[model samples]
Structures are given as C-alpha cells and as structure tokens.
Target chain A: MSSSELLQFLISGLQSGAIYALVGLGFTLVYASTGIINFAQGEFFMLGGVLAVAGVRIGLPLPLAIVAAVVISAGVGVAMERIALRPRRDSGALVLIIITIGVSMVLKSVARHAFGPNEMALPAFTPGPPVLLLGAAIDRQVLWIWGLTLVAVIGLTLLYTRTRLGRAMRATSLSHDAARLMGIDTAGVVMISFGLAAALGALGGAAVAPLTQTAFDAGARAGLKGFAAAILGGLGNPIAAVLGGLVLGVLESLSVAFISSTYKDAISLVLLLAVLFLRPQGLLGKSGREKV
Target chain B: MKTRRSVLATVLVALLMAAALSGCSGKGNGGSKAGEGGDAPYRIGAIVSLTGSYAGLGTPEQKAIEMEMKRINDAGGINGRQVEVIFEDDATDPAKAQAAVARLLEQENVIAVIGATGTSQTMALRDDIDRAGVPQVSMAGGSVITAEFDKNVFQTPWPNRIVVPFTLRALKDRGLVDVAVISDTGGYGKDGHDLILKGATVAGVKIVADETFNPGDTDMTAQLTKIKSASPDVVLLWNAGKEAAIVAKNIKQLGMAVPLVGSPGNGRREFIEGAGDAADGFRFAAGKILVPEAYGEGTPAFQVAKKFIADYSFAYGVAPDIFAGHAFDAFLVVTDALRRIEGEATPASLRDAIEATDGLVGVGGTFAYSAEDHNGLTEEELVFYRIEGSTWVLDK
Candidate 1:
C-alpha cells in the first residue's frame, strides 16, 4: 500500500476501533462488577439504535434521539439487572450466562417485531461532502464515532478514579459482601455499573448507526466481537479492553487490506483463541491468586 | 353393570378401530374417491423463513403464495380439489429447512412444496424431495439446484447464471467495461460472482478488482476503498439484503462515483431505501415488473399484482417487495400444475404436470419449463431497472 493509502487505512481502523473500545468497556464494566459476562451487551447496542430510530420517527431531533436512546438503554440495563440477574444472583455462572443469552434473544425478537426485519439507516449527522484524508475519503459520521469514543473513555476513566460512586463500585467489584458491610449499597453499585455499561453500548450504537445502518440482528456480531476483545485484553480490565479492541480492529482492517476480507471475523476469533491458549490471563490481565 | 360397561367399551373400541383404519387407508386413491364426491383437498407445503435474516424476502413470498391460493380457490378451486397450503418456518437455517421438508412430507402429507428460499436451505432438502418424488419449487435463484435436471425440483425464477449474463450485456451496452465484483463468501454469492466473471469475460470487460466479505459484516470501507483505488467503471454487488446495501452506502461514502450494477438484490426497495440517494443510478435486473402496457391490461398476473400491491399496502402499509411477486408467481404456477393434474393428485403426477408447465404467466414474468429445464424463466424475462427518487424505474 502507498503511504497515503496506509494512513487512510489507519484512520478507518481507528474509527472502527473506537466503537469497539466503547463496546468492550461496557463488557468489562459489567463483568468486573457482576462477575457475569453480560451477553446482552450487544442487545443494548441494538436497542440504542432502534430506540434512536424510534425517537426520530416521533419527530425528535438527532441529538435528542441519541439522548433518548441512551436513557432508554440505561433504564433497560437496570431493569435487566433487577429482574433477570438479581433473581439468579445465587445461581452458578453457567445459569447466569444462559439467562443473559435468553435476554439477548428476547431483546432481538422484540426489536425484530417492532422494527420489522428490514435494515434501517439513520439520517446522516452531517450533510456536507465527505472529508478526504490522505488518499481515502470518510464521512463526518466516522469522526463523530472517534470523538464520542474518546469522550466516553475519558469520562469513564474520571468516573472510575475520581468519584465516590466509582470507589464504591470498585469496592463492590473487589468484594461484594465486604462492600455491603462497609455501608456501600452493593445492589445499587451493580445496577449503576450495568446502566453505565448499557449507556456506553448505546452511545457506540448511536455513533455508528449513520455509517453501518441499524438492523435488529447487528448486535450478535458486535456483541461477539466486543466479548472477544474483552477477553483478549483481559476480561474485567478496562484499559486492556480498550487496547484489545483497537488491536483487533486494526488487525481486521489489515487482513481485509492485505489478506482476504472473507476471513476478517474469523481472524479475530482465531486471535482470541490463540491468546487464550498462549496466555490464559490475557495480554494485560494479571493472574490472581485463587480464593481459599 | 359390569357387562353393560364392557359392551359399551367394545362398541367404542370398534368405532375407534374403524376411524384408524380409514385414516391409514386414506392414502390410497380409492379412499380419496370415497370422500364427498371426489372433492378432496390437496395440500402444498411451504418452508419459508418467517423469522431470521431472510424474513423480508420470505414473508412477502408467503403472502403472495396465500393470495394466489385465494385467487385459485375463488375460481372454483383447482380441478375441483381445494388447495391447502401448510406453512412451516425454516428460520433460514439449512438444518431446520431439512427437518421442515421432512415434516411437510411425513406429517402434513403435502403433495408438493413451494419454498426453501435460500440456496443452502433448498439444496439441503433437494435430495429428500427428489427421493420422495414430490415437486419442489424454489424461489431461490441458485443455478446449482437446477444445473442438472431434477424432474422433481423446479425453480420459478431465472437462476443467477442466466440473469448475470443479461446484466453484463446491459452494462456492456452502456460502455461499463472496467468492473469491480464484490460478493459474500457463500454459495449464493460465489455462484453470482462466478456468473458475473463468465459474462464479463464474454463481454470483454476487465475485472479491475474482486472482493468478498462474510455474511453479517457491517463494514465495507476497506473493500470499497480498494475497489475505488482500482477505479473500476462499474461495481457489481452480488450479495443479498443488508450486505449489498452496506456496500452501496460505503462505496458512496468513500466518494467513489462509479455506477453500481448487479442482479435482483440491488433492485429491491430495501437496498434503495438503505442506500438512499447514493443508490440513485444503481441498475439491476428485475425478475419481473408490473408494466401493464407490456404484459397487457387485463392479464391475470398484472391484475393480481395490482391488487396485491394495493392490498399489501392496505394490510402491511408498505409496498409489496419483488420476492412477494416471485412467491405469488410460484404459487400460481403450482396451482396451475395442480389443476392440470385434475383427478390424479399424487406426488408423482403433480411433479410431471409442473415439469410440463408452458406459457404460464406469473408475477415474476412468464414461466415455460420442461423436464430438461427446471428453471421456468429465461434471461429475456428479466427487465433492467435503476433507482430513481427512491423508486425502481425501468432503464430505457
């Protein structure tokens, strides 16, 4: 590839990587607090897109529609935690996984019924000509994706480090019983983490909706990729999840550019499996001592 | 009292035995003759994707089939036997499709089957239908299903192989020689891409680039960028549904002004709506068009399509898709064949009648099939159309 072409590829990769990172963060946040791999993370993403479209259909402005999507998705995440996850709190991990899978299916089916089986495209965020970068051109929506992803990352980092709720959430993640004994509302922490994760997923969906076009079924693939990225970066580690998302996105872009486009998804799966086989703790994940 | 109860039980047992025997013997011709002046209901099965990725394609086809059945039944039924269509949801999975066909064969006891929408799904059940000696008509445009003549299996729509050549001819006529072909890595896409390549070679068109993506991929920027770099005069998209739409939008987003061309998937309303103004100037072969002037004003096909569009819009509040038209056509053809069979409603007889269909008008153009050719329509039946103002307008 030419230098300009390479730059174009990198820009496109980073744009997609940002979306992946946000989704990965959602996965990491929920897993960290609940010790459950919320398989419905992708559904939250899809819900965001569908809800935004619904808002637009109701004559809401684009920005308002995005906010509505985020609010609705966050509410849904809290409801899911209360109804589905809380009921099965004492259940095994396998049961929790199945429940989330069921939730994903229910969410997908509801979306299908409401949105119809056809794919839907949101009105473009910008009406101007596409911005050319190096030798390649990309739409302004991609820029929005990059901007939103960075903002989400910084916002989440600040929340986790500088806020009282963030410290409580960290405490809950470390030891739920201990946090509860120390006067932290552990249930509230779980709900808050799920809501925040869902909001991030929703933002990711809204940011990419103009580019990818929203479909009821888009979540399954996105969810799988986000989960794979989370696992690759060390499940529960926010920083690692973001890094992994970028790496996977860039690898996929490179594969499509150089190898074969057909094997792009397969390459991610292979990479995830390879990482697990080689380093069970993930790239940046530290191996923890087993509980007595 | 014991004797009274035993006698009542014996009588009930006798009646139950008689019912069971009659039900078993109902499979025979003699048994059918005894049923209310030979007015037996003939069952036709449909294995359609009522849910899943292909639901948009399958749902309309199902509706069309039902509408055709209603039309046929209104016309004094098909050869005096009421047409009964049993619907099964395949969910667009091949394994489910196989089981669905078996269920239709064993449980529903349908004389013939009308659907199996995707190529993989249809191919999965082709052997079972062939062995069962039942006629199976597919709306899927895969050529491999009918490449070798199967008297039992028929396709109402022209296969992609035939349609692809016509598409190339139209593009070549328009002086689009340098082409980029993008397909999905599946049977449908591979078949379509292969045909496009063959047609391009025949038409002396240079393939500037060839690319493929898996199903469910939302991003095509990389592929589109590469294709743009090659600077092809036209881009040939050979994927179905969402993938095709994504490619179209991405190509436009990349600011590549090449005209996009392809077969029917790109011709659908979904693609036009998904790609919006970017889909303008996109051309593809429409398997059928509701041109009242060409098909004649009062023809059954045209009349039905007009009513279908109105009713579909009234019912679903959206225009009926082309798949609905194809499904409607397939249903009409099957009903016509059933009427031809008249008294002999066996699976074998129905297959023979369907194979002998000639000059049958359907929503998807005229179908004329023989034992040698399972695909009823030809390339001549396909009309080229371009998206104009979000509607498919005939390309002059």
Candidate 2:
C-alpha cells in the first residue's frame, strides 16, 4: 500500500479508537468506583444513538438532539443503578451481574419495539466538504469524535484529580466504610459515577452514529469491546483503560488492513487474555501492596 | 368465627369447581369450533424471526400471511373451511428454530410449515421438518436447502444459482468485467459468493480480489482499501444488513468510487440510509420493486404490486421491502393451493396442490411450480435495479 493509503487507514483507525477510548473510560470509571462490571454500558450507548435519531425525526435540531441523547442516557444510567443494581446491593456478584445483563436485555427489547428492527442514522451535524490531511480524508464527524473524546478525558482527569468530590470518590472507592466515616455519601458518589460513565458512553455513541448506524443490538459488541479494554487496562485505571482502548482499536484496524480482516476482533480478545495472563496490573496500573 | 370460616371455604371451593368446569367447556367449544366443518382447518405453521435482527424481514411476512388468510376466508372459506396459520418466533437462532418447529408440528399439528427466515436456522431444522413428512417452504436464499431435494422441502426465493447468473449478466451488460467480491462468513454469503464466482467465470470476468467479513462487522475500510488497490471494475458484495452498507460507505470514503453490486438483501432501505450518497450507483437484483414506475405501465404484475404497496404502506405507515413482496407471493401461492384442495385439506393433499401451482401471479413475479421444481420462481422473475436518491430505480 502507498504511504498515503496507510495514512488514510491510520486516520480511520484513530477516529474509531477515540470512540472506543471514551467508552472504555466509562467502563473504567464505573468499575473503579464500584467493583461491578456494568454490562449495560453498551445499552446506554445505544440509548444515545436511538434517542438522538428519534429526537431529530421529531423535529429537534441536531445539537439539541445530541444533548437530549446524552441527558437521557445518563438518566437511564442513574435509574438502572437505583432500580436494578441497588435492589441487589447485598446480593452475590453473580446475581448482580445477572441483574445488569437483564437490564441490558430489557433496554434492548424496549429499543427494538419502539424503534422497530431497522438500523437508523442521525443527520450529520457538520455542513461542509471533508478536509484532507496528507491524502487522508477526514470528515467533520471524525473531528468531533476526536475532539470530544479528548475533552471528556481531560475533564474526567480534572474531576478525578483536582476536585473535592474527586477526593471523596477516591476515598469511597478505596473504602466505603471509611469514606462514610469521613462524611461522604457513598451512595451519591456511586450514582454520580454511573451517570458520568453513561454520559461519556452516550457521547461516544452519538459521535459514531454517522459512521456506524444505530441499531437496537449495536451496543452489545461495542460494550463487550469496551469491557475488554477496561479489563486489559487493569479493570479500574482510567489512563490505562484509555491507552488499552486506543491500542486495541489500532490493532483491530491494522489487523483488518494487514493481517486478516475476519480475525480483527479476535486479535483484541487474544491481546486482552494475554495481558490478563501476563501483567494483570496493566502497563499503567499500580501494583497492590499487602497490608501489614 | 369457626362456623363462618367453614362456610366461606365451602363457597370458595364450589365457585372454583364451577370456574374450572366453565373453562373446560370454553376449550371444548373452541375445539369443536375448529372442527365444526367435519374436519379441522388445514393448520400451516410458520417459524419466523418476529424479534431480533431479522424482524424487519419476518414481521411483514407474518402480516402478508394474515392478509392472504383473510382474503381466502372471504372467498368462501377455502372449500368450506378457513385456512389457519399458527406463527411462532424463532428469534433467528438455530436451537430456537428447532424447538419452534417441534412445537408447531407436535402441539399445533400444522400440516405444512413455511419459513425459518435465516439460512442456518432453516438448514438446522430441515431434516426434522422432512422427517415429520411436513412440507416446508424456506424463504431464505440458501441453495443447499434444495441440494438433496427432499419432496417435502421447497424454497420460495430465487436460489443462489439463478440470482448469481442474473447478477453476472447484468454487470457484464454494463461493461463491467473485473470484479471484487466481499462475502460474509455465513452460509448465505459463502453460498452466494461461490455461485457468483462460478457465474463470473462463465461470463469471462476476472476475479481481482476476494475478501470475507463476519456478521455484525461495522468497519470495512481495510477490505475496501485492499480491493481498491486491486482496482477492480466492479465491487460485488454478498452479505446482508449493516455490513453491506458499511462497505459501501467505506468504499466511498477511500475514494474507490467504483460501481457496486450487491445480493438481494441489499435492496432494503437500511442499505441506502447507511451508505447515503455512496449507495446511489449500487445495483442489485430484486424479486419486486415498490414503485410502479420501475415495472413500467400496464403490466399485470406491476398493477398487483402497486396495489399491494399502496395498501401495505397505508396500513403499516412505511413502504414495504422486497421481502414483503416475496412473503405476499408465498401467502398467495399457499392460499390458492389451499383453495384448490379445499374439500380434502390433509397434509398430503395440500402439499400436492402447492407443488402443482402453476401460472399464479401475486406480488412477486409469476410463480410456476411442478412436482420436480418446488421453487416457484426462476431467474426470469428477478429484476435488476439501481439505488437512486434513496429508492431503487429499475435498470433498463
């Protein structure tokens, strides 16, 4: 392949990687704060796309539709935490996982029934010719995806590092009982974390809807990949999850371009398993120390 | 207090007994109603993907069958007994399809079965369907369904052999020779791909590039890029659903801008929406078109399709896809046959009538069947159309 062609392929890979990173970050955030893996994270993504399309179909402007999608998905996240997760707060991990899976199935079924079993697309937001950089054509959608993902990541970093709420969240993640003693409402933090994660996932979904049309069952694969990225990145580390997602996306793209397109997804899964087997702490994860 | 409790318990027991007896009587009446005309209505069962990815294809099929059933009943109740159809959801899974077929055969006692929308699911349940001496008419385009040609099994859609040759000829007529084929790793895709390859060879077209993708794949940039590098005259896609559209979009994104051809599955609206302007130049074979203009003026088939589309859209609030046409044709064929064998509506009699169907016209072009050829349509029934501004326009 020509260098220009390679550049085009890489650009596409990076754009896709950005979306996966945002979703992976959401997975990491939820897992970091609570030990549960929220499988319904992908459903939140689907909600974003379906809601935006419905809003646009009903005469809302594109920007307003996107905002509505994000808000609605975040609200769903909070409701899921309250109605599904909280009800089984003291239940075993297996039960919690099943409940989340059930919630995902319910959301998927509702979307299928309401939207009908057809793929839908949101109207494009940007009105212009695509920009070309080094022979790689970049559309306005790709620009939005990369920009929003970076902004969300930086904003999340600030929220988690420099704020009082961030410290409280960290404390609660470290020890809920101790954080409660320190006057933190641990339950509120959990709700906030789920909402924020869902918002990020929603943003990713809305941004990629133009590229990958929204279908009722679109979330399952994307959610599973995002979960894989999180686990590969040591389950709860934000920076590691982002890195892992980017790496996985690029690897998948390159595999399709060079190795074998049919086995692209398999490459991600294989890498994830290898990482867990060899370096479970991940590249950027801190090793846990034994308590004396 | 003890005396009052005993009296209340006795009254509750008596009411329960009465309710149970009434429920039994209602069921008994329903059974008798089913057998009111001396013999039970000829029960035909359908296992369609009423839910999940295939629902878009299956739901309309169910509607068409119901509409045909009503029409048959209105026309003297099909030789003194109404045509009854029991439908179940397969969920597009093989195991579910097996269970569904078993339930329809054993519990519903349906004489003949119609549909199991997907190829793999249909194939998985074919042996059992044949074993039960129940005839099946699969709507999917898997040629293997008829390879062994059980007298009990039939196909409604154009087999891959017929569609592939028709597609090749269409491309060849357009002066396209070298082609790239992108197939999904599924029975339908593999079967279609092999047939296309054979047809291309017969047409003396070079196979420049051949690639495969899995179902549920979103990106096709790499495959498209590689195919573009090979610089084929046409890109032929033999997959269904989102992948076909994604490939179209990615082909545009990479600036390949070549003429694209697809299997019948690409005729759905989703392909146009997903590919947007990129799908404009795309061509594919379809059993029927929604627009009357595509069929030109004053053809009998065109008139019927126009009326069906108008009535279907009025009821469903959306234009019907080609599957809807095939389904309408399938329903009409079965109902017409049922009318023929109305007096003796046994499984064997119904199968004989269906197999003997000839010169029948419905939504899908003219369907002619015989004992040897269970599939009612031929390559001549398939029409080629190009995507033009979100609708399929006939390719003259």
Candidate 3:
C-alpha cells in the first residue's frame, strides 16, 4: 500500500477501535464491579444511538438529544441492575450471564418494535467534509470520535482516582465482605458501576452514530467485538482494555488490507484464539492464586 | 424474598424462551377448516423472515401475503377450496427455512409454498421442496433460483443477473466507468458480488476495488477508506439488509463523492430512509414500481403496477416497497395458476400451471413463464432511478 493508503487504513482503524475501546471499557467496568459479564452493554449502545436519532428527529437539538440518550441509557442500566442483577445476586455466574443475555434479547426486541427494522443515522457533531491529513482525507466525525474517546478515558481515570464513590466501588469489587466491614454500600456501588458503564457505551454509540448507521440489531456484533477487546486486555483491566481495542481495530483493518476482506472476521478471531491459548488471563490481567 | 426472586428469574427466562420458540414456530393465518364452501381449506404455506436481520424485506412480503390471503378469502376463496395460508418465520436462516418448508409440506399438507424470502433460505429449502414435489414461488433476488431451475421452484422479481447488468449498463452509459464494488459476505450480497464482477467485465467497466464485510458489521470505514484510494467513478454496494446504508453514509464521511449504485435490495424505502440525506443521488436499477411513469399508459404491466401500488398502500397505509411488490407478483402468479387449474390444484398440477404462466400482469413485471425459462422477467422490465430530495426519480 502507498503511504497515504496506509495512513488512511491506520486512521480508519483507530477511529473504529476508539468506539470499541469505549464499549470494552464499559465491559471492564461492569465485570470489575459486579463479577458478571454484562451482555447487555451493546444494547445500551444501541439504545443511545437509536434514542439520539429519535430525539433529534422529534425536534431536540443535537447536544440535547445526545444528553437525553446518555441519560436514558444510564437510567435503563440502573434499572437493570436493580431489577435483574440485584434479584439474582445469589445466582451462579453462568446463571447471571444467561440472565443478561435474556435481558439483551428483551431490550433488542423492544428497540425492534419501536424503531422498526430500518437502520438510523444522526448528523455528525461537526457536519463538515473530510480534511486532508498526510495525503489521507479524514472525516470530521472521526475527529469527534477520537476527541470524545480521550475525554471519556480521562474522565473515567479521574473518577476512579479522585472520587469517593469510585473508591468505594473499587473496594467493593476487590472483596464485598471487606467492603461491607468498611461501611461501603456495596449494592449502591454496583448500581453506579452499571450506570457508568452504560453511559460510556451510550456515549460511544452516539459518537459513532453518524459514521456507522445504528440499527435495532447493531448490538450483537459490537458486544462480541467489545468482549473480544476486553478479553484481549485483562477481562477487568481498564487501561489495557483500551489498548486491546486499538490492537483489534488495527489488526482487523490490516487483515482486510493484506488478506482478503472476506477473511477479515475469521483472521481476527483466529488471532484472538491464539492469544487466549497463550495467555489465559489476558495480556494485562492479574493472575490470582487459585485453590482449585 | 429468595424463593420469590428465584421464581421471578425462572418465570422471566421461561417467558423469554417461550417468546423465542413462538417466534420460530411462526403463527398460522386463515387455517380454519370452519370456513364455508370447503371440505377442508386448501393449505398454502409461506416462509418469510418475519423477525430477523432481513425482517425489513420479509415483513413486507409477509404483509403482502396476508393482505392477499384476506382478499382471496373474502372473495370466497380460490376456486371454492377455501384457501388457508400457513406462514412460517424462517428468521432469515437457511436451516430454519428448510425445517419450516418441511413442516409446511408434511404437517400442514400445503400444496404450494410461496416463500423462503432470502436467497440462501430459498436455496436451502429447495431440496425439501423438490422432494415434496410442491411448487415454490420464491421472493429472493438470486438468479440461481431459476438459472439452475428446479422443476418445483419458480422465482419472482428481477434477480441479480438482470439487475446487475442493467445497473452496469447504466453506469457505463452515464460515463461512470471505473467502479468500486462492496458487498456483504452473506448469500444475497455474495450473489450480487459475483454478478457485479462478471457484469463489470461485460459492461466494459474497470473494477477499481472490490471489498466485502460481514453482515452485521457496524463500520465500513476501513473498506470505504481503502476504496477511496482507488478513486472509482462510482461505488456499487450489494447487500440484502441495512449494511449498505452504512456504506452510503460512510462514503460521505470519507469524502468519497462517487455516485453510490446498489442492487435491488437498495430499492426499498427502508434503505432510502435509513440513509437519510446520504440517500440523495443514490442510484439503482429496479422494477418500474419505483417510477410507475416509466411503465407508460395502457401497458398490461402498467395497469397491474398501478393497482398493486394503490391497493397495497391502502392496505398497509404505506407505499408497498419492491420486496412487497415481489411477493405480490408471486401471489398473483400463484393464484392465477390456481384459477387456471383444470380441476383440483395438486402439487403436480400447480407446478405445471405455474410453469405455463404467460403474459401474467403483476407488480414487478409481466412474467411470461415457460418450461425452459422459469424467471419470466427480462432487462426490459427494469428502470434506473436516482434518489433526488429523498425520493427516487427516473434517471432520464
């Protein structure tokens, strides 16, 4: 490939990987706090995109629509924690995972019925033509994606280090019994994690809605890719997860460029399999001593 | 609280499973033996993707069939046999479709089947349909549905063989010579991809780039960015579902200003609406249903097109899309064959009658079926249209 072409592919990959990072970060946050893989993370992403589209179409300004979408998704996430996760707190991991899958299906069905089967698109945050960068024309929406991703990462990092609730949630995730003895509201912490994770997912969706049209069934693929990103990082590590998402994005783009486009999905998956075989706990995952 | 919570999750899981099962099994319509003037209602089966990725395509087909069923029943059934239609949701799956077709043939005892809406789904059910010796009028856009003709299977709508060539010719004629083709790896998209590869060569167009993405891929920017480097005159996006819409928006985002041409799958309203402003200037070769003026005054196909559009819009409260028109054409052709049957319509007789269908007026086109050529429509039936102001206008 030419230099410009290579630059184009890299930029495109980073843009896509940025969205995956946000989604993967969501997965990591929930898994860290709750110890349950939230399969419905992508659905919250769908909800944000769809609701933003709806909100804009119904006469709200773009910024208001985005806020509305993020808020609504956060509300749904909190409700899911209370209604589904809280009730099933005593259930096994497998059971909880299955329940989340069920919840995902329900959310998808509701979105389908509400929005019909047509995919939707929202106007870009900055609706401008592409800017020529290093002989590669890059879209303005892609800049929005990168900028928002940076903001989310910084905001999340600050939330983790500089906030009382974030510390309490981290303590709860480490050991609920110890957290309880220290007078942390473990249940409330879990809810905050769910809400925060969902908002992040929604924000990612809203950011990318202009580039990738949002449909009712858009979640499954995003969820799978995000899960892959999370696994590529440690399952519950935030910093490595974002890096993992970028690696996957670049790998996928390069696969499409070098190999056949038809085998892009297969090749990325094979790489993921190879990574799993080599490093069971993920690249940056902390290995704990297991009695079993 | 513990037992109650456990019961709640169990109940929710059970309810979800039940919903999933019911979705798969599909609900029957007008299967009542209680209908008058019949010993037993002559069961006709349909398989459409009622709830899945291709649901946008299949739902309209199902709606058209349901509307036709009601019209047929209200008009005192097909030749007084009291038509009972059994609809099955294939969920856009091939294996599911094969099972559904088998169930419809064996359990429902349907003499004829009207669907398996998608190409792969139809092709998957082809074996069972051939074995059962039942007539199947398919709504899929694959040329293989009739090219490698089964004695039992027939096709409605212009397949990629006709659509791709017509589109390529349009591109050639418009001086948009170099083309970038992107298709999903799914069956229908692959079919379009193959056809475009062949059609571009025949139409004397250079393929600047060829790309494919998975069916549910959220972003096509990687592929689109690659295509941007080649700088083709136009882009041909082929897919059965909404992914192509993403391609439409992606092109604009990437500053790729080439005209976006698409397969018949993009002829639907949903595709246009999904693309929103990006839909403008999008071009495709489709049946005259999009621009009925192209049909002219006093043509047999024109009259059928006019009425089908009006009645379907009246029935569904929205303009019937190309897929709906495809199913309507199949319905009309099948029902017309039933009307022409000398005696009772059995699988053999219906197959013969359907094969003998000639000069039949339906929404898609005038299908003149013969034993050798099961796909009755030709390139003459198609018209090129460009989306202007979010509505398709005939490309003069």
The C-alpha stretches of model 3 lying farther than 4 A from their native spots are A287-292, B1-39
Selected candidate, larger lDDT, 1 vs 3: 3
- Which ten contiguous residues of candidate 3 chain A have the minimum total lDDT? A283-292
TM-scores of chain B, in order: 0.86, 0.87, 0.91
Candidate 3 structure quality by residue, lDDT tens digits, A115-184: 8776787888887677889877677888887787788777777777789987886787767789989999
Error of 3 at B4 (Å): 30
Give a tens-digit lDDT track for model 1, residues A1-292.
Answer: 6786676666667666777887888988987776667878988999888888888989999999999999999999999999998988888555676677777778887887788777777887776667887667777888888777778767877777899988887788777899999999999999999999999999888878877778787787778778777778876677888888888888887778888887887886687779878876668877654211
In order of listing, the candidates' clash counts read 0, 0, 0
Candidate 1: list runs displaced more than 4 Å: A287-292, B1-40, B74-76, B290-304
Local accuracy of candidate 2 as per-residue lDDT tens digits, A1-292: 8987787777767766776787888877876676566777888888889889998999999999999999999999999899889877777445665576667778888888799778897766784556778877777777888888778878877888899888777787666789899899989998999999889888888888887788887787677677666656655667777777777777777887888876877886787668766775565666553100
Alpha carbon deviation, residue A88, candidate 3 (Å): 2.2
Interface RMSD values, listed in order for every candidate = 16.0, 14.8, 6.1
Q: What would the DockQ be for model 2?
A: 0.23
lDDT of 1: 0.77
The TM-score values for the models, in the order shown, are 0.91, 0.91, 0.92
- Alpha-carbon RMSD, each predicted model: 10.9, 9.6, 4.6
The candidate, 1 or 3, that scores higher on DockQ is 3
